[model samples]
Target: MHESLPISVFIIARDEADRIARAIDSVSDFADEVIVVDSGSRDDTIAVAESRGATVFRNDWAGYGPQKRFAEDACRNDWLFNLDADEAATPELVAEIRKLFAAGPPGTASFWQVRIKDVFAHESGPAPWAYGYNQIRLYDRRVGRFSESPVHDTVRPPAGARLGQLSAPMAHRSIRSIAFHVEKMNRYSTMQADDMASRGRRLARHRLLTEFPLAFLKAYLVRRYALYGWWGLVISTNFAYTRFLRLAKTYERELAARARSDSGAA
Candidate 1:
């Protein structure tokens, strides 16, 4: 039976006390092993996870890519399900996952991309694409691992690997309030800027003014974000703005460096 296949659920978190238990509980039904890799959390996240029978490991803060990879490598099973502290696995998803392991997925199959249901405060709607939500969360661990990006890390499967989507959805509570969104935007924007800087790339003015606006329009209007109403508007606008801010910060740094170089010649 697919249920007999060794499956491990791995989570990487920090200061996620408020939400970690929900994540653990959601997967407890099907997960053969639940491993939590925490990056020096000061809160009760560790205790909560331990109480839920999760094997908690403490490591210093690493970038998202490295942190996730570390947790993946630690899993005892060859099949890994990577989840965030704020995300929960729906029963439908759990059943589908169990079925896949029973029949044994193809050798060429590397990952399953799960659909996400985004819930706003007291409201539920489809997530805008700009929210960067569609993600590959389940995979055969032997084929490949996640890339080592400081932010927005992606799983890279081996060559000729096939990707598929699951019918069940992963419930995501992304925007608890406007304040929650703001805080996340601020944190992620800084991480993105740092990532670009490390890569020796700067955002060009043309790209920012031309490309970003079009991207926003495609997400908010063309994607019919209006259907989600005001909350959708907030999601779209903030999503676009955060991207702009990340690139703009990178550009601003370049300008400062150029000015310093010119001043030195004078």
Candidate 2:
């Protein structure tokens, strides 16, 4: 067996019994402890995580950032790795992380970013030219913690903190199926809209006309989703629609506020 590192890997899950195992298994061999924070999953998520030897904690749903913060505090180690229930660390990524700690704790780097690529249900793995985004997944909790935004769940590294990047990629199984993807997007868009409205954000009326097309072009052309052909088209279209939906919902909230103001004046 490979020597385990003094790293605590945490995963927050909700009704993800089917995919959470992969996330836990990927880190099981090398991590000192695996922590799974379950937010009241109706399915067997807690049971499955326990079966895989992950210490499970029950927390009420409080948005992404808060949930992750809870998991960070629950970790026993100063070094923490955050993995989504739908994502798995590739063998290459696991090796890279091990190498970082081979001599001792990573030198001056307080956090490391990993490229996370989408693995569609139809595809066996990420394409050679798959589009991915970088996120800070491994970090010293003392130097950084996840932001508390309800809609944005990203780590906020302190100013001047040293950062490093890992070339290896993490596999993100974000899309279960076309139908499931749509449902998930709808829910996310609602949350995004509510967050925006609470922050007093307003959208120009003209944005309703241009948001979808602009978003589609960025996803399809700039993000290289076009490389996936028909699957790319479907993904891009859905991505555009989600963006448009958020703007529309935000605009609706603005209009309702205006109507209330006018009624009060009358």
| Candidate with maximal lDDT | 2
Candidate 2 wrong stretches, greater than 4 Å? none
Model 2 clash tally, residue pairs: 0
lDDT of candidate 1 over 47-80, digit per residue (tens): 9999998999888877989898889888998788
Of the candidates shown, which would achieve the greatest TM-score relative to the real structure? 2
> For each candidate, how many residue pairs have backbone atoms clashing (under 3 Å)?
2, 0
Candidate 2 matches the true fold with a TM-score of 0.98
Clash pairs, model 2 backbone? none
lDDT of candidate 1 at residue 226, scale 0 to 100: 60
Which window of 10 residues has the lowest lDDT sum in candidate 2? 196-205
Query: Candidates' TM-scores?
Result: 0.88, 0.98
What's the distance in Å from true for residue 53, model 2? 1.1
